[model samples]
Target: MIEEIDSMKNLQNEVGRNARLVGRILDRLREKGKLNEGVPLENGGLIKIELNHIANETVKEHFLEIANDNRILAVALNLFHEEQKKENPMPVILVSKDVIMRVKADTLGISSQDYLSDKIKNYDALYTGFITVFVHPSTIDSFYTEKHLPKSQVPELKETIDIYPNQFVIFKDSFGSNKSAVARYNKYTDSFEHLYSPESVWDVSPRNVQQRMAMDLLVNDSIPIVTLTGKSGTGKSLLALAWELSKVLDEKVYNKLLIARPIVPMGNDIGYLPGDKEEKLKPWMKPIYDNFEYIFRNRKTDTNIEDVIAGIKNIEIEALTYIRGRSIPKQFIIIDEAQNLTRHEIKTTISRVGESSKIVLLGDPEQIDNPYLDATSNGLTQVVEKFKESKLSGHVTLIKGERSKVAELAAKLL
Candidate 1:
């Protein structure tokens, strides 16, 4: 009887041990599987891990293959992209610092989380070197006329302030009409232009100061290369077109004008599209035509369409492929939609600018159509970043999208 009782006790003890082990496993799963409260993971089931943000092609492909394996359930990512659904079909998630990647992931039905729980640095403040300041309305004029502020008064400025000549200053007075100004360092005048007054041609325009700087660089004719960057509707293409028109027709700065933009589509391969090069380029070049139509609006009355066409012929419009082996001289060149171009492609385009030829590259760094490049690393952004501080190089960021109210709202919201 005692022997039988011992066997029964052993069985009960084993059962309890098994139950405890199962409970521990469940706890681990719950900890790993559940998304943190208020975290913006689209699907909720994801574990954030620290990983490299930028990976090479082979590494990316290998990771995708690993993600597809059914046996693996949890993914630890330094960066999570909802749009990386092409290779990872499973319920995968990402953890990344990149806001665009999170947005892309959410759109692609993937889960995401931030890698760091600590406070993140304010990116805008870091990049622009801006400091928010409050000033008495009476002293607003004084501040503009005199660039110098009292050293004692500088203490009243907010902490973590960034100081850059290109930085903007915001005056938040008690009054409702607060004014904003950009700090413009004038190499010509050997002083700072408050950007509120008409001290220089460069400082008169507050909205497109960066673009104005770019135009100035082109106009100086000291540099053969110039690049302009802004978001869509921020006057990149229009400014380029305007500069070309002014230099070519009005000032007689150059004998000819040339223009081109890449033929790339969103989320698809160009090989699938039917038709010849011109047909493929027509859709992508629609924005270019829109600018031309607007510019030639009044000129269309006396000059016919054929005349304009002939004029454009003198100002060549050819694909980037055809630009190779061509030597262009005495030309004002503008390459619109240049965000799609690779570093190699940009190098090729810039090299083709012959003696006395000026080249203007304009595009939205954020709206890059190229798969390999992003906002920071793309050719357009790269060029601007590399050349911004140089005397011969300048850049302008057009903040107010002057296209329309609806367009502005759409850019902000959607």
Candidate 2:
């Protein structure tokens, strides 16, 4: 136990070091005027970023091009567009490399792009874990019938497998393998029944095992709490919302669907953000609003957003702050940007869940907004890492962005 604690301490130190390096890179960008039009204050005071006066004309034009392409630009660009629209009719664009930024931008018809042209490798792929192997057609019997291959030669299984009488062998296969990849094996349904999806539960189709798991937890009345973690552009929030809507609107399983996300910023300070709390939260929650609008939009008729938002007390859009000291019952709750929350905050949020309630916390740890916590320390990661062994909990790391090929390639290459 002592050695394990020490190992965790060392890992924490290493993660902190990397986070500091990331902070330094962002600071350098701010100094070089690459981030936004704002200048950092000495005492964490008000920031003064010029909206129209960017240093490079080429970069500005590039931003304009991105805006023209129907991508939602950065927050600064969005603010600039709103401020300058009346004075000067310049196109608005958002510049960013973050996958969530592009996703949000495309949803809102704002232009956006990565400041850097080339894409970096997926960080998760670089981190080592249990290897997966795929077996060949005829090798199934050999793997189960014979002794399992030596632990060193065989790829380690990440999760427990249940074997039953006359189960099929499901082998793991990789890029390079002999006659077959790792051997295959199957389990019996007698021990634990694997749930299948209903044909018409608000277009709830699994398409894969992970999504199947998500759907199972969502549709089942027994499970009240579900948490999903993945990289940006994943269907974590989308799936949660879709499932919640299915329950509340389509099936009438729940009384209401309430969605809320944190209002944390990426960098610097929000001290100079003009206006009240609602105004401050508007920028952070724009993505949520955009999603709501997209889902509520009508193809045939011209319906405005206010009417859609007012359609039912059944669906509520709220901030995480307002959730404290409240008992939410008979409602499907989704906490987007949950990675920004602390352990205490998550606890508070979870405690508010009353009878006949389901809370789904969805966010990307890699794209965390909270500065004090890293990927491992944040509430979302802690929940996922700790609760993975629990039968009631499940998670999926989405690899594909079904948005567009450019967005997909950008996520991979740039």
Candidate 3:
């Protein structure tokens, strides 16, 4: 009983580029013998497909008067009214992702709801991958003295905390005590392990405890995937790039550093701009280049930005569009702005990770630009929630913004 308006023709035409799900729907329709020739099923129910025309001027005028800014919605309203006037009418609900369209439907006395099939419930209570627990001063002393403690020994931990695999914990010495230590819970060994304190990575040290936890997970060779969620200025991308370069250039742990980001625009598509692929991607990828330049400058290298870029034979930056159908192995892969991707896209991208490679997904859910996605529905959040308990994965939500004072203020106040 799916009804598509004629305005959807534009969407159908662009289906080849980014509508694999829509293409699946079309395939299902053809398999049911309902693509072009509407056929009746065994229960004497028939699927109908109709083209839109201006049969009722009154309905069209009313829709225009209500939804003048959206012609697609106007046409949809007209079709809904025409169907409502049928002899044996059924309940018709307009499902839409646009809030304004749903509001307009409500004004016109038509039923509407947000598209909720792919939405995650309880997104507000989503996992943060970190927790703070206060313990006795003696317990903290034992942790420092022994360097590790088994979960069975920490009786206080059971009262207030349910630790997940690889979850970071801040052990505070009661409420008013200033003594604190950071440790990661290892579910496999049932122990709290000490944090990795790297003096500096490319001259960039962790500015906060969360960032330290992020560094621990990022540099650990055993963990294959890590997800970092935070607002702008939280150094999610900066830390990822720093660790990636450190591993590839200094430690030689990975063969190459591969970075990819979805080409979703904040306003308009880059296709409308005039240029080929690389030229068009320059604006979108400028932040990556800026981080690279900062890292190179901190290294005290005697080379310009262009020369540094040209001399690096082990780094590759490309759009996420072409990453499908390829197996990426033994590389440090960073997917920046991962919140712009859907769950399907995230699964496909992660499946491409071959043996001995680590993938880091960095993005801010609040700063997503994709129209069809929200904070609770984006791929980054999905991955964080799904892999919260996996031994091979770790996640950290960076709260403090280290980019600058003004940037931090904007991220918080505005």
Candidate 4:
């Protein structure tokens, strides 16, 4: 049974429009039932839907005491409490995406939990897109001399290493051995290919192996989707933007560079700052502009910020809101701060990618500001985990910070 409240206008609005996942689910239920309030499953089970009106005095009292300022939550809490009082009372647990709502349920002595259906277990064990494999010293030599080595030749590599497509492998001679080589697994050939030397993208060279792998994926035309996750100073955005600029301007791989981000606020809405759309986005997009400035400064010592901005004619910076209902083709699209988006939103954005377009999702999962999301449940991590095995997609988790010593220290110690 799915219980809801009539006072919850959000649910009512969704049901009325028949939009969003919830609304669509409810619509499916309506189609299966004569009264438009139930759904029959393939297992011969029925799910009855109930919408309760807020009228109980005890519920009103609870609302007055605990949720006087939030009517929707109060109504949901009232429904939960009512469900608990049934003759054959089943366990009533409130599942919510909002942390505060779950806290309020706890305060009301109600069982509550964050929605866990799409959440990943053991985020620490999440795919890093790379693994270390110890092999004989000759194996490293063979990789260097032949440019690639068949997986069957690496006898020391355990069968349980679970290498996925496009995953990077660090070949070491032995434990604490100095002889080492970095290679990417090619699933097609079932071999490990030698890593390309770090190449400059708009005069910005990768400072580490992780960044090198990231650049390889970013610039590769075969892999159309790339995800980069790391801490603030790890250069996720810088690398993505630099590669995007290189692709659009230098190589002419794509027609345009479309950069966007979810408009989630750290505290208050940007709408409160009193400015137009572009003006309001300035604060959010300042980091992207900073990357552009760095690239320009590196390319030309005397380049000014305005000169850099003016030179960029093939780039478009817009909110994610405008991306829907549009077919974005033949572009290098970069979605920054992607950790703030939900799985559904991510799917929608990705589905908008037209023919020959590449999309890069860059974010620090640890730095998500969206209240309803966490590192394990956010869209960025979802994409990383989902596409980890796909040949057309590649992901890199950047660890080394390139911003500065202070930034790196703060990311670590602070």
Candidate 5:
């Protein structure tokens, strides 16, 4: 805690925005100190602040080999907990967001836990928009012929499984004769409708059933909010951009296509990067730009990339840091790398959507770059689980990597 406090005073050590926040806190400490005399304490609370209660030499020497700030704090905290145990029988648990630190605390016999207030669910149990259901061959036949199957058709299944609107469903034959059908649940009609999306978008076909299901959610105008979570090469961004380009350019359903990704919040050293915000962001946004080039090239647009972007003046790509307080209407917005966003930032970004706007959160929960966010606590998973029951939103987790043989192997093997 002491080392962290010292580091926060230096702009070079602290994050760009946290310096001012720490300064205000320091100022408040000084003001409160003047009123309270020698020691500063809260007005009325069981909790007490221990200032300069540094750990002893034994604990310090034990952590000297690691020489990291976090390890040092862990040593100090462990010592404090040990000392407190002598006076009281209360449990001293170490609450932190760092996984490694939690492990270290456990090694030292300290009770540690990840901060759970922002966590929506565990990564393994996260809501995937698609589910497979084994049913009678007669039900699959009826679905294929009638093109829709009422939820009542599977009354016994509902008692065991919960259904949500816009959820992708795959009905398989119970007898296992390879008879199957793919459908999407319609909460309004309470029926399973056949997948009705273009076979391909921007000349890119849905490579697998998950991709096909994702496409169904992407192009649905009725579903205003969508989320796609997957590893690299899963085509989350490609599918999102495909829909944005097709909708904004071909369909003209939305006035603009906006893509915003976190730059400074991704724990990258953007301060030392050359040029302005846009230039600094280019390297980070190169993946999105690459998808654009691939889509335009495959679509047979002879125009240059610059000219293409110039012609489609409705499309915008920039950093998420600049999206605050902006009301976007009739726009298709994609929040890329959304796994790096905090819960507060997610709420802020999603709330910026205006009437007629469709927002899609896209990223891999397993590949988060934010220091304080993990798969379960990140904005992507938060939205996926929280909005699963909402009719206006849908989500799909793409498992297959369609980028290339080598890329797919690396995404899995590495």
Candidate 6:
């Protein structure tokens, strides 16, 4: 990074914003700004390792044929392990996220593993905040008549099922009948209560069961932290934005609407920009503005489109760096594309919320851009699993893209 001395990362600008991968090593190097070119450490120095030759091309092709930087590192580690095995009574392991590095190290008799400290196990089975249970037809009837059913009435709850607070439940008759009801688990009452929120906002409504659950949670003032996760075009960001608009501009539930996202696409991680903060964020916030435009220009709201959209107030779309130390109170905050944030970044974002504020985290875990994170280890999935049982939090995993025919097909087939 310091080789050319051109337009690049500045240490002053990277504070609290850059990725944590090489920061520690860079800090150590920064102390000794100019290293002695010929000096070497007491124990060792950088040495070039050459590739081993073999007659078989096919076996060799699979074995370090690429000769990339990762392969070179793996070969070096293997060589060091082979030498140290005779002296030190310790295991030499290669810790990396690179698949080729791990596989090559394992094949060369060196222990290897992905960083496991923050990785969530069995991410495929991550909680969806919704489940379907088959019960007797009479139970569905009772739910319709009483508007609430005791947790004990559902025999499935007594078994291996462990439902979370604010979990949405779909009750279907075990028999062939079409009787069904959708209810949400009320942790305080120990019951499944019927959803009563007005489902329509600006002529936009949920098209699937999971979307309905997401709307229910979004409209509920009791649940301050909401998470919406799904594939692209599944309306994860749209739903949060819609509900935030209604709450902030219409109902005045919160003082302001602050929307922030990880600054990945702009540069590396919240890199330095030359203009004002808002100007620097305009390009990144186009999606948020587009959603607002779509909501205002819907088929049924053309008459009030200009008035409603132009008169909109108290909404801020900016980078997460600006929102770090501010006391954000009584605001409806949405963190878009939250999957790119690390666990520490997510924690810092959440900790900034003040009293009477609502924070909704929206993202598709499968679509992650951070090199150090995965679907399992990303902040979105981690927070969903960690807050599954919190009475103050709610989550819904939207399935099936409702954006368009081509969008749905691409989400599945592509």
lDDT of the candidates, in the order given: 0.57, 0.58, 0.82, 0.80, 0.80, 0.78
For residues 159-237, write the lDDT of model 3, one tens digit per residue: 6555888998888888567998889998889999999978888888899998999999999999999999998999998
Please say which candidate is ahead in lDDT: 1 or 2.
2
User: Which window of ten consecutive residues has the lowest lDDT sum in model 5?
Assistant: 45-54
Choose 4 or 6, whichever is better by lDDT. Answer: 4
Where does candidate 4 have its weakest 10-residue lDDT segment?
1-10
Please give each candidate's TM-score: 0.55, 0.54, 0.83, 0.85, 0.83, 0.78
lDDT of 5 by residue, 1-414 (tens): 535655666664225245657556656777655422343447652322344444445545445654554555555565556677685656667787778877877766778888888887467878888888899899988888998999999753677557888998888888889888889999999999988667787887888988888888888989999999898999999889998888998999999999989873445465667888667777887777788888878566677674677576788988888898899999999999898888778989999999999999999888877776678888778999989999999989999999998999998988
Q: What are the RMSDs of all candidates, in order?
A: 17.6, 17.5, 4.4, 4.0, 4.3, 7.2
Report the C-alpha displacement of residue 209, candidate 3, in angstroms: 0.5
Q: What is the lDDT of residue 54 in candidate 3?
A: 29
TM-score of 1: 0.55
User: Which of candidates 1 and 3 reaches a greater lDDT?
Assistant: 3
lDDT of 4 by residue, 1-414 (tens): 223332343543323332345545766767777433557877896665435534446555655553433454555567676677898766666677778878867877778888888888879998998988788888999999998999888987656567888899888887566999998888899999976655686778989989988888887888899999899989888888888887888889999999999878888664665579777777877777888887777464566674566567888988887887999999999999999988878988999999999999999888988876799998989999988879989888999998999999999987
State the weakest 10-residue window (summed lDDT) of model 3.
1-10
Error of 6 at 193 (Å): 0.6
Which pairs clash inside model 6? Answer: none
Question: Which candidate number has the best TM-score?
Answer: 4
| Model 5 pairs whose backbones collide | none
Error of 1 at 394 (Å): 0.2
Residue-pair clash count for candidate 3:
0
Candidate 1 lDDT tens digits, 125-148: 213313346666655565566774
- Ranked by TM-score, the better of candidates 1 and 2 is 1
